[model samples]
Target chain A: MTLFQQILTIAICAIGTMTTRFLPFIVFFRGEETPKYIQYLGKALPGAIFGMLIVYCLKNVSVLTYSYGLPELIGIAVTAVLHIWKRKTLLSIAAGTAVYMLLIQFVF
Target chain B: MKIKALKAAFPHTIPILTAFAFLGMAYGLYTRVSGLGFVYPLMMSTAIFGGSLEFVTVTMLLSPFAPVQALLMALLIQARHMFYGIAMLDRYRGMGLKKYYLIFAMCDETFSINCTADIPEDVDRGWFYFFVSLLNQSYWVISAVTGNLLGGFIDLNIQGIDFVMTAMFVVIFLNQWFKEKRHLSSWIGLAVSVLCLIVFGPDSFLIPAMVCIIALLTFLRKPIEGGEDKV
Candidate 1:
């Protein structure tokens, strides 16, 4: 793409991102009562987002029942246990990723 | 104050850096593989800073796809930020002129983390928010540049790399889940989305599922438990 094209795409993306991210603030955030609907969204959105997120992360892994499933499953299990146990973000990622890389490189 | 703000942002932006750096490195390396050089990642990072959007950009660029289609898809994928913003109304309101940075930095994790954090009484909210925003972007830019440069030297079998963000989301969810009450609507969302993905097939289900999730969550607000049960 041309320089102009990159700029235009970036502009559209920035605007779209900003609108979705910032517009809600200018509308509902200024007042007394925070909308109950918004409240409900906050409660529920993360779960749905993360649920999709898990699927998204695991999507690339081929699932012929058990062929390439070990590493991904182990990674998830490690991450879950570490997170629930340690509650340390960096450690969870590092340990999980490290274990995963090691598993793929050496184990499976 | 500005300098302090900048400094303050560095520490809070650690996760952003850790997460984006590997991805950036991968992107840069991919640029190398795609018959490009350091200039590509640098330029893309500087001009187009969106993380997943950058991946989409690579796909579109690598193929014969039109820029218009790539651009639309980028926006649609990032549409979830609207939810992030809405989640941040209370915090964003208190921010003064630094609202610009806050808005820019309100990417997925920063918003989620900040929403959970109890803003201290005496701390400068603007600086706190600005610092995280600034640091996160810098981390991404730096990582992408590094990855591009390192691409030549490394032969990384980096498939499934993009899933780090997804994994991070799962980590964050699990982190929050045990602390917080069950969000029934989101479970409903998961069920509905998987069904949609199966029915519509992978290509067509995302936007529809997201729409269904958002609509269902919005409506389920009143009956569900209050959003804040944990930190």
Candidate 2:
């Protein structure tokens, strides 16, 4: 691809991405009374969205494969436990990631 | 004032600093190994900040150019951002000029942190969010440049460090799980996504999972809104 085409392709991507990010704001601007359904969804969607995100992150973890996803399983467990026990977001993430790194790099 | 907000937001962003540093380096190395100059990765990361799409763009660049296909694929891959935009409508409202950048830079991690983290009352809300977005972008860009410049010369055993992203999401999920009284929505999200993943496979499960999630959540609106226990 020429430099022009490459730039165009990347620009297309950037534009596409900006569309998604800005679409909701464009559709539901604060100047007007937002619909009740959207408002409800706005309130309710985060819980599920967060859940879906978690699943998204783990989408590739195949339990039937080699190592049987043990690393992910233990990693998630450690992360969850540390978060719940300490209630410190950064610390829990750091600890869990550290454990997973050690497991995959050495123990696994 | 901006400095104070930056100070407040920086600590929360430390995990991202680590994650993006390595991830960005990987991205840079990928571009470098592909025989592209540092300019490509730098510009891609700056303009198209979404991690997955940036990775995808690498292959697209190598392939025969198809502008329309590239655009459509980008839209499809990034459709999830629409959800984030909707979810953030209220909080991001009244943010003024920072609002535009906030929306533009709303990657998965940024959205998760800004959405959930309780910024102190004293900190400037807009600035706090601005710092998060800005700092995250800097980490990614800097690391990408480093990797491109170093070009496979650096090696470290950071094999599973990518799990940091997963761990971060899991931690956020747990935070939301405990905060809400009803686990119905959370469960629906997990079950539906897993179901979609199994049925559709990982490659194309996300859109279907998102659609299923929205459909189910809309269907359960009466009970979910009324209260989960009432269902």
Candidate 3:
């Protein structure tokens, strides 16, 4: 692609992205009361979104593959246990990541 | 006040700091090794700001020019942000000028942090959100540039390190789990996403999964809001 074409491609990608990000804001503009359904969704969506994100992160892990996703499973388990145990965000994340790194590096 | 917000926000972004520093460098090296100049990664990271699409943009730049395909693919990949914008409407409504930038920088990690973070009452809320967005973007840009400049020389055994992002998400999920009294949405999200991952595969599952999640949530709205399972 030519330099201008590359820039246009990037610009196109940027526009697509910005549209998604801005759509909700524009539709539910200021001074207008947000519809009841969307309001309910706003209240209810975050928890689910967080869950979706968790799954999104592990979407690439396959049970059929070698190691069979054991490392990811173990990592998540450790992260959950630590967070539930200590209630510290960074502690759980770091410990879980460390366990995964160790499993892939040495154990697996 | 801004400094205070930045201080409060920085700790919440600690995991992102680690993940982005490494991932940004990987992206930088990938761009550099693709025979592109450093400017490509630098500009993409700064302008696009979305991690996955920015990586995908590298391929788009390499391929024959097709602005239409690039735009459509970008929309498909980033459609998730629409959910984020909806969820954030109320929180971001009154944030003034910072609101625009917050919306602009609403990548997954930044959205996760700002959405879940319990900003202390004394801290400036708008500034807190702004700094999180700013700091996370800065981390990506800095690491991307560094990776491009220091290509191939800073190799470490970072093989399993990408799990940092996964770990971060898991922690956020757990935090949300503990906070909400009802687990229906959480379970629906996890189950639907996993099912979609199985049915649709990783590369193509997100849009389907998100659609399912929204449909199911809307279906269960009455029970969710009826306070039968209040959080």
Q: What are the chain A TM-scores of the candidates, in order?
A: 0.76, 0.75, 0.72
Q: What is the C-alpha RMSD of each candidate to the true structure, in Å?
A: 4.9, 5.7, 5.8
Q: In order, what DockQ does each candidate have?
A: 0.40, 0.49, 0.50
- Models ranked on DockQ: 3, 2, 1
Structure candidate 3, residue pairs in collision: B181-B231
Judged by whole-model lDDT over C-alpha atoms, candidate 1 comes out at 0.65
For residues A33-71, write the lDDT of model 2, one tens digit per residue: 658877677657777876776777777788997889899
Residue B222 displacement in candidate 2 (angstroms): 1.6
lDDT of 3 at B184: 87
DockQ of 1: 0.40
What candidate 1 gets wrong by more than 4 Å, as runs, is A1-12, A28-34, A65-68, A102-108, B4-98, B108-132, B155-163, B218-223, B226-231
Q: Considering lDDT, where higher is better, how would the candidates rank from best to worst?
A: 2, 3, 1
> Model 3 Cα displacement at A60 (Å)?
3.4
Worst lDDT window (10 residues) for model 1 chain B? B158-167
lDDT of 1 by residue, B17-112 (tens): 777776667667556666566766676666556665565555445544355555445555566676677667767776777886777667776775
